[model samples]
Target chain A: MIDIALTEEQRDCLQELINVAMGQASDKLARFLNTFVHLNVPNIELVNFDSLPADFTENYAQQNLSVVSQGFYGNEGIRGESLLIYKVNTLDDVAKILGYEPGEISDNEQLTDISSILTTTFLNGLAELIENQLSYSAPRVVSSATSSLDDHLKQLSFDWDLALKVDISYMVTDYSFDCDMVLLIPGEAVKNIQLVLERILKEY
Target chain B: MDLPQINQFLVKEINVGIIVIDAEAKVKFINQFVLSNTDLATDYQEQSLFNLFPELPEKWLKRKIESVFTLNTPAFTSWEQREYLFKMRHTRPITTENDYMAQNCTLLPMSNNADNQPELLGFIIEDATDVCFYQKQLSQTVEKLEISNRTDSLTKVANRRYWEERLAIEFERAKRHNQPLSLIMFDLDKFKNINDTFGHVAGDTVLIEVAQNVAQNLRQSDLLGRYGGEEFAIILPETDAEGALVLAERIRLGLAMHQIKVDEGTVIATLSLGVICICDDYSQYEEMITRADMALYQSKRDGRNRTTLYQA
Candidate 1:
């Protein structure tokens, strides 16, 4: 297995860049929904593909979850996937905010809507910072309330061994709605991001 | 033909509808597929898309297109999410249940030839009616399978595995909330005699009638399951000893009064039930079930067609 880890300087620089992108995403979400959004500091880690299912189950088991995943590809070999995870129970509140009636189809629509906004805005912001042009695949609901995260993760076809994982939480103010957005940059993309981070750090 | 002409020919011949629009939502170019598929006119060259399709969800579509312009990336909508972006009829030979054609639309940032910066957006709409139809059918089949997996085919009640799972869940909830809960175990008196005299079919009919009668007498919250051959169980939430005994007696009397019609002849069947209410001494649902089984055995000993509540 090829071992790849981000250095301390690269990690800090990447974290700072992610913070700015996440802030832009939250602002766009706030304007779109007409509600204030609170964002948590993003957590970054390098995880092995084999351990992903167990790690996902350990963090997000027992409770019902809905997950949406979208792929993004960019210039200079920058590519990754973005996953938006929402608790099943909190979808009703989110539906109300999006002016949708409480039902299964509407709940899915709400998830798709919010996921599109968050994924595109956040990735575009990051791509701009790195001076890379990125295009996206359509967002698809990977799993709904009926399936477990472990089962869903186990079935995913991962071509890479190691991935740089970034987790960000978005909580709507005065609402029982909070979702986690996880971005996974796999294999060569991690090295590419590290190189970009080094370049930015040198400039500073 | 040159590259631009070949590209134009391919775009026009493509099965999907492609439309190029500027930031103002004015139509710069629309392919033949879109015009041929929908009622839209060929004269919609410079007209606004919203004007041509007045029923369009202007607010949502505007935001979706604006996002692509701002982010310089592709945005997508699936039939599962929004049903359709454009309300057009499907031309498939097979009859569909949907009123309008289902669509999956993608909006991509199109760069100008002079500069590499994105100046216009391209919309590709794919007919997803067949996909939607197949997906609905598949989900319906899966739902039926799930229900069958949890239900007993003989008695049309909860099966053994599903009942035990629910019992465990209810047991934990009652313990946590300190709420009263009850379990009842019962079986037909001399069930094998009927199977021996008439046949297994007669026994099955009796079991089905008994299950239907008992289900009618129980509350909606109560769960009845076919535990095994000739044996059944119930989990009643928020029920004390008195309520449990009353329900058990009702079930017992209801079955005793009804005559089950089988292929051979009408048969009278009776049930001996054992009932138990939750108490501090009980730690698990299985223990309560064991006590209920013992009470049911006591009912059989004291003659059949009776309800017996477990003491302590």
Candidate 2:
């Protein structure tokens, strides 16, 4: 492969940056859910197309309604895919956090009404951060039904040798409340991010 | 060009479904005016009588086809010979795509062959249902006769001879224009066994149905003809190898998905496709075919029912 691997220190720096970035995403999601939101980055991987995790639907499945959004970043300079996932049941806990009576069916319409609003707010916030950092076009939201991450990779026209991957996961825990987010980064953008992180750490 | 004028012409000016079957009761040719008027729910351009109208008393039609092929006699089925008088049905084959007038059909005998004998049994259909009146009659017997020489006897599409004649011209045109031209040479997977197991009649049915389905998927400008027994060729005028590969995949998928009902069991058919794009300076069409044939063999080797494009 044409890409350079990240050193341990560089990897740590990149993870720290993503931790901060996802914190921003968590705040927006919490505000939309009207609950205290917790997002933690557990692990990140640098891999190839063949190494992607299976159970595609299960990854996004949740007790409540789920919303998944996809967008591209770093076309020329840094390139990869970003995905955001939200579980509706988790949003139920969010409703309780934002000062609504818990477990009230009649008032659930008020809770359900936030799906579009919250999805827009969180996805847009995340996209803006990536766009500013990468200097690329605005993220185009892909439909969850027809768009598979693998299909997206296959459609890419990049020189595969230069590609790198950065896969990250986010989890929300509120004692009794829970939700998750899985972020899939295309192969090329991982290398770019690693370089940027190294430069930032050296300057510090 | 305008919808209103076109609508007016289709309604008032065309009586297109007057078809005449010969004494052997086979469709010789359909008129232009009638062809436009009648919509066959399926693409039947250059199709023979049995292939297009398969359910049209095939047992009876086969005898007639044999007689026409053997006796060299013109068979005429007069307008009065119908078993029953039925209401004309208006149909648009691609209902999802466009709305068109329904066809009013009338069958008759038209003869055009080499020996000055009526070599063909024609079906003249009129488009009279929507318009409510006969507009004009178009007899393309002579034109169809010239075309028939280039057509396969069973599928009623371009025959090997036609492909040989036409591909050379298209090759020259592509070279002169520096345009992309692609060819897909394919054959039915396991066709010999199908003929061996099921009678030859069933095999013929499979060929006819497969050809019709492929014809339906092709662009109007694309040239489709049976290259030989169990093999077909499609010439895509302005397509490169990549585009041809995609088209071959589509054809393979379409055939695999379409289940042709024969009798008790449904026949699942597969195809191996070989695609080759003609280079700008291509001189001999055979080279393209050879490349395509190699790709087709590769597909079969790779596991049939797939598409393989020629590397060079």
Candidate 3:
């Protein structure tokens, strides 16, 4: 478990690194989608469980389903967590990217299929962003939307008590789609990130 | 917490609806901005989201929130593009100890000094209606301008200026290939007489008809253009003098068979044709065109309703 936290300067460096990594991800996604994609890591926050707002408890007591993937940067020595939250159907973004008239999706089965395709596409793009240094866990598909994402996170067994949340926003060509990419990294990984920066500085 | 202080501090400052619920998914916090912007019920505290935006997928929203608390991971809703004109927004679970403020749903996530769970996942909604509408208009305007520049005003075919620019390059290519370039030139048999007798309007009708007739007879690769008033030209690559003569004869016969009528029962016209094939000795495009003009004059000399080939 990581015990050290990053300084404000270090946090800034982390944000810049994430921006670069996500920018690369955007390029790959753009090529796959046959449109230009843009990625930005706008905000990064360090959070603990009890420090969280009261709404979180009220919302998750009954149902919670989520998918989480663990990736480690061998060179940077930083390990991070990626979560895919699919309580909401992702096809809205897809339809927006298609730039067509809105069509209704009546059945849950159709929503599931669309979500799976979208999740796979996003994960594939995220992998390219990390320069293949990270591998994604197979997405855990579930129907009890409330319990699934949280359940998946529990299965990963990572420390949520000492994690940094990286807030990301990505758009595919002309803001056709705007979505959130939330990455959680352990507090210990922050020290590793500092070391990586030092190494990079030395090399430069 | 003073109610007015909360409302004034909350409204319109952030770009997304702020709905805060305690551990039970009951509305614990509803900012004024959420009340004004979204269609959610105003009496939101302790009220379930299912009771509010019934149209929203409540089960999915609950699942996303639950996952965020459990894994201490921020769960995200898919980008919800507003139907009318608002910006895309999504809700994510934020857990910070000291900051009980709902998710900082601005375009930029708010920074904080919370020691414990500082994962303030903001719900960001941007207004893209104006931007999108203007961008679409810009694209349409560009397409319209492009179309107008390439179309001819009279014949609706590619204009003489475009043809001259394009064919000069083709002529250079033909010279490189050492291939024959044939030209067929035609003029209305008594175009001046028609203008004098019937009026300029009749002359124009006759010219339009002649252009259509010659255009129909030529191959797709062959070029046809109105070289000047009552005069038309055609360029046929890899065609010899004999081939050009045959094509010229076809144009003559085609025009002879087609007649344009004025106001009364009187028929309007016929056309004289001239054919010339470019040889290795022809140094310039102007020279080839001059020879074609001479052949056209010869056609008028021999008789008006037939084609004549340049013999030198």
Candidate 4:
């Protein structure tokens, strides 16, 4: 496995980039759902595939989650998969926003729709700032409400040994609706991202 | 370059519906599949998609398409997620179950040249009716299996194994919160005599009737389970010794008054119940069960058809 690490400067730059991206994404979501979307500070981590399950379980083991995943690729080796993890308990609020009766089918629909909106808006904003033109695969419902994050993470077949994991959480202001968007840039993509960060840092 | 004709033929002949719309969601190009599936006439070019299909979720679809255009990426919706984007009849012969086709749709950004930004959006609607049909059946079977696994086949209440698991969990929760929890253990009076004289089938009928009667009398939060042959147990969370004794007496009296008609003749049953409430000395749930059993023994010794509260 290749060793991947980000300097304090690089991490700070990436964090700043994610903050701006999250703001743009939340604004779009607020307009669409007519609800104030609260944003959390983006957490950046370098994760190994072996310890990924343990890391995920530490925070989300107790939660039943429905996850939507989409893959994106761009020039200069900029590629990663974005996961939108929705707590099953919060699906009722999402169903209300979508104007549907809360049930299994409606829950899955709301998860998919909201995930798509968040993933595209956030990734597009980040891609623009980084000067990379990225294209995404269709967003897919990867895990249902019956599964936990630990189980889902264990089942994943990761081709990359290491990943730059970025975590951002969104909470609806009044309602109990909360979700997390995680971006995993794997292996060589980390190096590519670092070079872009360094260039941005140099310009500063 | 020579494959343009083939490409055109492939696009038109494909089973899936393909449509290309500009930023305004007006149809720039539409294939034969979409045309055949819908009730539209010949002149459909330049028409807004919402005008073409009045049933479309205009606000949501427009936003989705706009997102794809802005991000230059594909977006997908499965039948399980939203059923279908357009209300089209499925070509499948069996149409009794589903009224409209189940669809999995993909929206892609389309660009004429490699270097230019995407100017149009392409929509591909694939028929997912067969997949959806099989998936629903599988889930239904799974749900039924899950329920049966935790339920007793004879009584339809929770089986001994599942009941014990709940008991352990509730016991720990009670200990942590220092809350009152009660357990009632009971058996039908002279149940063995009924099986010997009226046969096992009659005994089964008696057990079923007794289970139904007890279940109907309990609160929603209480769990009743068949613990052993002719023996049943109840777990009452947030209930004290007095509450447990009251429920036990209700069950005992209710059964003694009602007559169960088996194949042989009418049989009146009675119960001997042992009740135990949570105390500091009782560290584990097994200890509570043992004490409750001891109290049940006392009830049996002092004659049947009575409730005995364990003195912890």
Candidate 5:
């Protein structure tokens, strides 16, 4: 990672900005599902692309992941990708909540559809709170092999110098499903994001 | 005024099954095609997609349908993963195998009516069993072809070509791990004399019988191959010179004890053997085989039925 440092205040401010945006998205999702979503404190890390899986999943192995990715381009010259990572095991509680019974037709299609919707809504919400009209592309599904997580991340085709990793964890109320979402911003976009944060700080 | 036939009217009556479920996963409707093909009950209206099918993945169904409701788009799956979404069974013509029918399924989000009713999820199921069956048969045929290429027709053992390839792989592995490796090469003793006196048929019987005897005496890890017309080779991985010689002696003794029957009478045959270990001084795998060859020549010169080991 390029060793650009963030002051303690800057980190705290960025975290707060993300927290508020994600909280709104969570509320919207909760309304749609008719359930509460538990959110964890969003943490930041500086990591290289090659070491992403190892650095990201410090406590977990490469389990089955359904990744929904959306790349948003900002009018303020900041660009980033947001990934909603589902552990796949959470789908059962989700299905039951959706009025599906104990036995039925497969919900594989349903899982992909849900992945796309939740990811897009959550990502677009974050883009809006940043005060930039970030255009989000259609979400794409990546049911990648769990064994070679790094290889799949390497093949992402983005020549990003550094990744500002934002880790978010959420769970559905009364459901066993808990999932992680990540925001990967490039090094060049950091300057633009800081400027945006500065403007918000001056106004507030 | 009569209206022209639209795609919806044809799709409902087509052989494929069409079913619709709501965002709450309750079965909204089942077309005639779906009702006739599967054992789907008529009391499906407002029934949970889970309790109606009772065999499908409930959570997977919810995920797909929920995503459809959220994304307002279509999603798809085929016979490759779970074979069929339904438990409908059918017979395959080629293999005479009776199993679940293979199917390709598409799920599309349906817009609500102008009356402001809730939106529904649409599922189109197409039978794809025949294509799946043929794909399995082709892969089985390709596996048989692969086995044929690696086997020897004469002795029913690994052919020389396969043996050579395996030897190179083992050679590098042994060197890298500092493990012991040995090679044993042997030939039927007085094989030309037996062919001249008793005829070539008797000679052929003796060679077949001897190969089987040697194979029986070998360890499971040892690879036995027909090196040439009358010469056989064994690749012993993680075996020292002494271990190879001991195995070779068992083969030589087994061949001496066994008797083969020709048309005229019974014929007895003996074998000569050589064993050599891979040493640090050796540059390549071929050098180890050469040392075993030198010892084989020594064994034949000393007499016909004994085993010889090259010290250096």
Candidate 6:
């Protein structure tokens, strides 16, 4: 595989900043839930863009997963999407935590609402912690129904040669509440991200 | 009563349900919008959220909530995907169409202080039933309008304009795949004479019945359209010259056998059909249709109820 264009140091720095932002975001969530939240440092990968959906749920492909996505625009051609994926089986737990009795109805409106809130907080946190200001569109759920992420992959409108994949798993530590969030940065944004990281390194 | 008190007031009165879950997976707080709106009678404090909203998917909810609880990243749910996180009936002030309430839900991670002290899951649920209802109505109307525009008013068959577009598409596809394509233009023989002899009513009956007869003989993949003023056209994909000839003769025979009874007497109507197979020499789709129309003219000139093929 042609390695990602970023140097090892640049990649490590990017991961560190991403983790910082994730921590900041989890702090907001922890206060919201009146509980402690746990976060894992994202597992970063550089892969061909075609392999995104499959790479997202390689471990839990058998279970039904919900995908919510939001697009963002950044400075100096830094642009990409943040996708959130989680199993559908935990939707009941989500309804209860949200004080909803969604019942047996499938494809309900509340599903989008939950994804929107989580994606927004996440993208914003990741943006702010990296010391970059970014504009975001409202979050949307592109796939659900089946466990396969192909529907999600097929519907993606944009084109990209390569992507910087950030995979982070979060849970409440005690409960079985687990989810994976993936951030996709395109080949075009690699230079911009490197510039931002370098500037941070020099200033501090 | 500082900012937090005022914020609590807004959460209760803002017309959106607010539910907060603590780190222990217990209900921290549910605002008035949620408490008054739902059918729950018991106090929600310290209650397991799962017990209250039992239908909520256990796997998805736990994963999302705990993610926010730990990762500090917020998540969202739109009505289009999950419908309603709760089983509340639609309460929007308008016509009732939806069975369950439509809601846009937000899952927020909140920390008590600047530091990640005691964290809670903040949920904001908004009623979206009316919006969803109007959107559905709009798409349905658009679909109906589209269907009507493409259909012939009298026979409920596809109109000439729609057929022409399909013809061009079929031509390109046939060329790309190196498959044989055929066209047939059929006309009710001496239709003007029928109108003069039996009046316009009989002519109309013959036209409708002729279209039905020709359509019944053709395959499902074939396209049969009213080709303007007593003429109809059929496009057959992947069909050779012989297949087109057999179907054209079958339709001519079928129409001649069926008789229409008007106010005066029984009228026997026959159709003259012209068939042409698209050859490698032809570049434009119009050439194929024009040749079929010419062959139709030949059928009419030689004898009334016969089928003719275009000759080189």
Best by lDDT: 1
**Cα lDDT, model 1, residue B269:** 94
Candidate 3 Cα deviation (angstroms), residue B243 = 3.9
lDDT for each residue of candidate 1 in A1-204, tens digit (9 for 90 to 100): 556677888778888888898887777667766678888888877788887777778777787889998888988788878888887887767665654445634567667876877788788878888887677877889898766666666665556656556777777776767677777667787777777888889899
Interface CA root-mean-square deviation for model 5: 5.6
Q: Which digits, one per residue and each the tens of the lDDT, describe model 3 over residues B92-171? A: 21321211112222211112521133233333433333444454578789898766665465665556676666568767
Positional deviation of residue A71's Cα in model 1 after best superposition, in angstroms: 1.2
Task: Please name the candidate that would achieve the greatest DockQ relative to the true structure.
Answer: 1
TM-score winner among the candidates? 1
Q: After superposition, how far is residue B16 of candidate 3 from its true place, in Å?
A: 8.3
Candidates sorted by lDDT, best first: 1, 4, 6, 5, 2, 3
Q: Where does the lowest 10-residue lDDT sum fall in candidate 1 chain B?
A: B109-118
**Share of reference contacts found in each model:** 0.46, 0.00, 0.00, 0.37, 0.06, 0.43
CAPRI classification of candidate 2? incorrect
Q: How do the residues B57-167 of candidate 5 rate in per-residue lDDT, one tens digit apiece?
A: 766666666655654445566675567887665545456363777887777667653113238888888778887887788889988887788777767777899888888
B140-195: candidate 1 lDDT, tens digit per residue: 99999999999999899999999999999999999999999999999899999999
Better of 4 and 6 by TM-score: 4
* DockQ of each two-chain model: 0.40, 0.00, 0.03, 0.28, 0.08, 0.21
User: DockQ for the candidate 2 complex?
Assistant: 0.00
Q: TM-scores for all candidates?
A: 0.87, 0.34, 0.41, 0.78, 0.60, 0.65
Candidate 1 has a TM-score of 0.87
RMSD (CA, angstroms), candidate 1: 3.7
Off by over 4 Å in 1: A7-41, A50-64, A75-77, A87-105, A129-131, A169-179, A188-204, B91-95, B113-118
lDDT by residue for model 2 (B60-178), tens: 33543443333332222222122212223345344322233333332222345222334445443433333322221122565667778888989988998888788889888989888
